[model samples]
Target: MEEKIIAHMTAEALYDFTLYHTYSKFAGFLTNVLGLAVGFMGIILVVTGKSPAVSLVFYLLASAAFLCFTPVQLKLRAKKQVQLNPEFKGETEYTFDEEGITSLHDGKELSYSWGQMKKVVATPKTIGFYYEADRALIIPKMDFKDRFVPIMKLAVEHTVPGCVKVR
Candidate 1:
């Protein structure tokens, strides 16, 4: 609704986005596949009556790996990114209009027209204006306070319908 929405980007916010982005991709699929395969093997072993204890251990291990491995790995990656990247530790000012969005961060300015954006993804905790397949302008919901709805509305109006995902 406002001409410009400025949000301070913190290291934690960057870390959160990194973790969410990584988990939403191939890593998520791989995690599911690996977990299912191991668990299925355990089930097969149990049905065949081949060492019930060992099968149980396999099942537990599979579940643990499924629930913990990717999250831990992603967390570490996010932390490292936030710590190592200067861009992730500063304030970013975002301007939204009918034409597009412009972001000014760390004395660098980047603008993206609605047509140029690949997608606009809104999750529970963040809204990502993705211009490239692997790059995005991430806005944490926490920073938006009460202005989240207007921002989403503006995005929906300017961005392509099929490419806008708000959930």
Candidate 2:
């Protein structure tokens, strides 16, 4: 009934994230394919010898790649890191009944029943649970205890897109 969370996560800071397990290996696969595309761009910039815009385009592509993938990569890395070592320990065991979610990470806690849940999604490496329109709780596997098990069937009821189908 208790769960934990990580705070102040950053690119440089390394932490295990359980969600990384869902996608790290796959990320590697994507990295190779994407790297090849980058290589093609490099060839266009070098082998073909185009205009000054070529260099600008190269820089733009590099910047775009960095901007697009770093956070996602870090999310995966942090999840993996949490899988190795956790930082936050959220107290999810307070209560889930009518009084609802009394434990707080800092000093704030909200009370809500399962009926309040709106959506749930298990992406490549992260499990997302949406309560309202814009708020969500993302949990990674590495954040869990070593080999912790989940009740996936019941958990599916709370995801945004219901990625986990209960049988």
Candidate 3:
């Protein structure tokens, strides 16, 4: 059976999804952890008078800079997406089934088979289907009228490997 869901893409949803996607990678986690560690170590060194104050300042600033970069990147990406696909600002209709998804926008239809999906990420506010590492088709939770969540979860798990559910 085919299930249809209609939703609009909001900036907040895009930001949240982008933030999650940005920091969910192994490298991102590692970098964040390492940055914190370096900053902490720099603080300790400064307190002990073993290292120059400049060292501490540099480490702390570097960590802060890295932490601030992701949000800026996400904003740029979202802006570019909006600029490139002005039609995406409107309502999107998605048809889902055992095979894959079909999206209707501005009288144009696009289809993606199950095999084309790399992952399906379900969050409290949105469900994102990632076809590429940085690109996704986002579905807002408010769009569902019935028990679509369970249906989406089942279909995703059956079709995609490494499906993630974020609380």
Return whichever of 1 and 3 wins on TM-score: 1
Tens-digit lDDT track of model 2 for 33-131: 675666566666665666354575675576467445755666776666545533333333222233222334456665655555665545434454456
Q: How do the residues 1-167 of candidate 3 rate in per-residue lDDT, one tens digit apiece?
A: 67888888776677677777877889779878877888888899999999998898898998787777778778877666655766657888888887788899988898887788777787667778877777778887778779476557656555655655544
Quick one: best TM-score, which candidate?
Answer: 1
**Decoy 1 TM-score against native:** 0.84
TM-score of each: 0.84, 0.42, 0.79
Compose the digit string of candidate 1's lDDT tens values, residues 26-72.
86778778888877778777888885766678696877789678767
lDDT accuracy of residue 5 in candidate 1: 72
Angstrom error of the Cα, residue 120, model 2: value is 1.7
7 in model 1: Cα distance from truth in Å? 2.3
Best by lDDT: 1
lDDT of each: 0.77, 0.46, 0.77
